[model samples]
Target: MTWMVTGGAGYIGSHVVRAFGQVGIPAVVLDDLSSGHREFVPEEVPFVQGSILDTDLVTAALREHGVTGVVHLAGFKYAGVSVQRPLHTYEQNVTGTAHLLEAMQSAGVTRMVFSSSAAVYGTPDVDLVTEDTATAPESPYGESKLIGEWLLRDQARATELHHTSLRYFNVVGSGTPELADTSPHNLFPLVLDALAEGRTPRINGDDYATPDGTCVRDYVHVADLATSHVAAARALSEGRELQRVYNLGSGDGVSVREIMTAMAQGTGIAFEPEVAPRRPGDPDRIVASGEAAARDLDWVMRHTLTEMVTSAWQARQAR
Candidate 1:
């Protein structure tokens, strides 16, 4: 069965598309290329250029590609920018998800795998976040993602929809050097870009409650994340019941300072990161246990931190 990947031209989405191909699954890509690079999507894949907000376009693409399932990854993904542009965030994420669901129903696509965010947890009081953790989204982007999950749940309850949402933070690394994270907002790209430009990488915040006085975040390899997406799709296609939500995160987290150290070591760039004010809506630490995902999907940390940095650096230099 052919699976359609929304935002497949994006860094993470491109890897997901390739993962599907690795398993011999026919895949189609739907992307607006607003932030995604057309080159990120392979030449062999069917590429549909459009926004998910366009219900007609999405429906047409789904039908044209004979798509039986979708790995939905399209949305306004910048959490910091979403704080400033809440309306735009809601329009693209909340409204856009609604439109996508409508299109899926119209095209008779019953399976969906939503790529969600750990931001839905906001600043959890606990050390480790789980599926049972309370969702208290602080930013508009996070709120929109939570709403997207809700939309899936409500639709599944009312229709023949079978879906699951995978929440993750800081997806880094590369399946191939050709596919790189081009986002200016993500930490990896920001640091890599600064170093590539021969400038000092800036740490957004210091003096946090953490031991290193820097924001701590959970990070996973992009390829590993993509593998779980495929696993989720396979489970859904096989009519296997899956949890409503799963956190694809490492139980242990690394501080920004620690990440900078790793970057220096991995890239062989010895320079201290400049201290900068924290971005709005950023939490001090966000780590989660991926036990559920590991139990259901074939989730695992296949790459070490060094590997993550070197792969990202290689890809960044390629771009």
Candidate 2:
């Protein structure tokens, strides 16, 4: 089966593309090069330069390639920026997804693996979030993703398209030898950039309710997350029931300070973080339980925090 990976040139998307290719799964990539790098996609795969928002381009590609499954990973994903530009975020994350869904339906593509986010759950009062938790997104980016899942739900009810929306939390780490993070907004890359310049990485807050007085989050390796997509596709192909949503995470919370310490240790870089006040809409803690994914998708996280930092640092150095 030929799989079409949207945003296949991005950090996590590129890893998914590589993962599918490594397994000898016939895959093609469609990216607009907005946040994705063309060089990230392998030369072996058929790469199409286009946006999911473009219905004509998307439909044509799906039909031409006879794509049976889609792994949707293209979207705007910055919490802070989403607050500043709600319309732009919604247009890219929601409208873009709607367009992709329509194109899929038109082209008779029946299965999909959407790249959802844990931000959809917002700041849950509970520490370990499950798929059953209430979704109360605090940022527009999160809200947009929530809407993306809603689109899938509505579409599945109306058609034969089966989708698995995997809500991801803090997707990090590297997969390929060239694992440079092109997104300038992510925490890992931001911290790495600061350290590379011998500058202090600024911590938004260090007086939260969590240990070390910092907010905590679950950081998962990109490769492991990509593997979950493959499993999701397999389960969908096995005639698995209707639309499903699962949380893919490490099942452990790591504080901001802890991550910084780990990075310093991993890269042998001694740099302090400049603590600042908490940013707006910032959650004190967000960690996901991968029980649903583990049980349903048979997923497991293989990398530790040290491994995440070390791999990311090495990737940054190579770039």
Instruction: Give the TM-score of each candidate.
Output: 0.98, 0.97
Task: Write candidate 1's Cα lDDT for 1-319 as tens digits.
Answer: 9999999999889999999999999999999999898998889999999999999999998999899999999989998889889999999999999999999999999999998999999889998999999999989999999999999999999999999999999999998999988887888998999888899998888988899899888999999999999999999999999999999999999999999999999999999989989876667788999999999999999999999999999999987
TM-score of 2: 0.97
Q: Top model by TM-score, which number?
A: 1
Using alpha carbons, what is the TM-score of model 1? 0.98
lDDT (0 to 1) per candidate: 0.94, 0.88
lDDT tens per residue, model 2, 196-233: 88888888898888878998888889889988898887
RMSD (Cα, Å) of candidate 2? Answer: 1.2
Clashes of each: 0, 0
Residue-level lDDT for 304 in candidate 1:
98
